[model samples]
Target: MRKLVAFEHMTVDGYAASAEGLGFEFTWRAYSEELSAYGDEHIRADVDTALYGRATYLGMRDYWSAVPDDPAASQHEQVHAEWVNGVEKIVFSTTLESAGWTNARVIGSDVEAQVRALKAGPGGTMQIYASPKLVHSFVGLGLIDEFRIVLHPGTLGAGTPLFPDKSALDLDLVESKAFASGAVYLRYRVA
Candidate 1:
């Protein structure tokens, strides 16, 4: 069986986004070279399938797809963008009519069944990116095999949290690395 990993950048308070809303704006304060390299390494070494909700899928498609064409883009950014562009991207949504990016497709319904089938099939690690609602659902269903989180030093205080309020998960720490910027990368296997 393939591993289903939920990757998230979270505040110390456990929020994935600010109380204002869910987007890229709230999570980059503690970004560092170590964190960036770690992300790229994970993508290169572990992930072959990327999972996202409609909003995140659209956002990532726009950003990563354009990185290769940007003259000012760094080698790191270009390489990661290339990997993202080639990987199988599965967008989970009911309203998204199409996945316009390359190697991308839309799974409009039957999330639980489809996801289970994906996990059961042959593949590299499947990573769920910046989709808190989808992550929560996966967690609730006991579908996530691993949790890889970059915990920023500060707190959002109020925002879209990473986990559901009433649910509980038992996890075993697999790895932990602290970056110079006070950000910490934690990897846990669901127990």
Candidate 2:
């Protein structure tokens, strides 16, 4: 069976995204080579599938789809882009008519059923990629098996939160590392 893992980059105050924009572009202003390598190691080898909400799906597709052919992109960027492009992308959205990326599919309804079916199948890890809303939903449904979180140093006073108010979870720490960029990586198994 495959495990459903949720990966999120969040501020100290627990906001996954800031008020101005999605947090990807600026959430980690102190992003370092160490952090980059960490991300590459996590996503490049173990994960074979990427799950996303409509907003995150469109955002990532627009950016990552162009990296492989862009001359100016860094070697790491290109490599990760290639991995992302090749992975099976599952987008959950009621409004999205189609997922335009390669090896991508959209599940418009029966989210719990579809996700459970995928988890029951044989595959590498399936990761929830930076979709806080979807993360919340999966948490509510008790579908996420593990969580890989990068906790950045700063705080966003107001923004999109990673969890809903009054949400609770019981997790057992699996691994942890602190990067030179003042960011901490934590892996937890649902308990």
Candidate 3:
């Protein structure tokens, strides 16, 4: 069986985005060497595929496929980009006609059923990226097996929230790590 996990960055107040998505003023605060390395190893060691919604998929496709091979690009950045470009990507989107990435497949409907089949099959860890809509569906539909989030410190005066609506969930704290970058990484097993 495959485990479905969500990897998200949230504010201290638990909002995933500040009005718009991960850009503009709300861009990733600062890159921590420790945290970035941890994230890279976390994915390289276990995760084999990425699950995304239309927006996240497109954004990632554009960004990762173009990690510049220049002096400005760090070794970590180049390696991370290569990892993303190599991994399989499954996108759930009704409006998207074709997957922009070669390693990507688009599912227009019956998302839950298809995802269930994916989980039933033999596979490595599947990580859901920055897609709040997909996250909401996976959580509310009781499909996700684990939730891993990095909680950054700050209160976005207003923005898209991680959990906009309240739904009772029973979860066990599987792991927690605090970084010198004022970020706390948390992993929870859905119960």
Candidate 4:
């Protein structure tokens, strides 16, 4: 079966975004390089489908779509923009009327079941990116196979946490890498 990978950049304090639902404060050294390489080698190579919540999807769509034309975009950023725009995007949102981007679809019903069905279907892999609420929901359903966390070296005292509820989880470390900027890339398989 194909794996369902959840990728997110999180603070040491476990918050994915700030209290106001903005994620600007979360910074990673060589983030564009890391993200672009991950997208090309792991995400784009293995997974053709992306799942997101409304807020994250919109935020990502706006940013990724504009990177190509942005004068300040780096070489890595431009590549990521192309890769993201080419892939299939599935947005799970109850309030979204329609998705404006190409290859984007709004899924408003039976999200868990649909995700399971997609995983069971014929595909290489599926990725869920930066959707904390959806990630927690999938965790409750025991759906995620692996988690790739880019742990940046910062602490937001109060913000939207990565895992909101108190639940016991056993994870086996598959791999780990420490960057020069104090960021650690940890890969864990649900055990």
lDDT of 4: 0.81
How much RMSD separates candidate 1 from the native structure? 1.4
Candidate 2 per-residue lDDT over residues 1-191, each given as its tens digit: 89999998888888887768666655557588899888887633589899999999999999999998899999888888888999999999999999999999999999999999999999999999988989989989989999888898898788789887777888999999998889899899999
Return the top candidate by TM-score: 2
After superposing candidate 3 on the true structure, give the runs of residues whose Cα lies further than 4 Å from its correct spot. Answer: 21-27, 68-71
Better of 1 and 4 by lDDT: 1
Cα-lDDT of candidate 3? 0.81
TM-score for predicted model 3 compared with the true structure: 0.93
Model 4: lowest-lDDT 10 consecutive positions: 27-36
Q: lDDT, candidate 3, residue 116?
A: 91
Give lDDT tens digits, candidate 1, residues 1-191: 99999999888888986756445465567787777888787633788999998888888999899999999999888888888999999999999899999999999988889999999999999999989888998988889999999888897678789998897989999999888889888999999
**Regions of candidate 1 where Cα sits further than 4 Å from its true position:** none
**How well is each residue in 1-191 modelled by candidate 3, as lDDT tens digits?**
99999888888777776775453244356448988988887634689989998887888888788885556788988888888888999999999989878688999899889999999998899999878778988888888888888888777877666764886788899989888878788988988
Which number leads on lDDT? 2
Per-model C-alpha RMSD: 1.4, 1.2, 1.8, 2.1
Which 10-residue window in model 1 sums to the lowest lDDT?
Answer: 19-28
**Residue range with the least summed lDDT across 10 consecutive positions in model 2:** 21-30
Q: For candidate 4, lDDT tens digit of each residue in 61-129?
A: 998998988999987778778878989999989999998898999999998788888888897778888
Clashes of each: 0, 0, 0, 0
Give the range of the ten consecutive residues with the poorest summed lDDT in model 3.
21-30
> Per-residue lDDT for 112 in model 2?
96
What TM-score against the true fold does each predicted structure earn? 0.95, 0.96, 0.93, 0.90
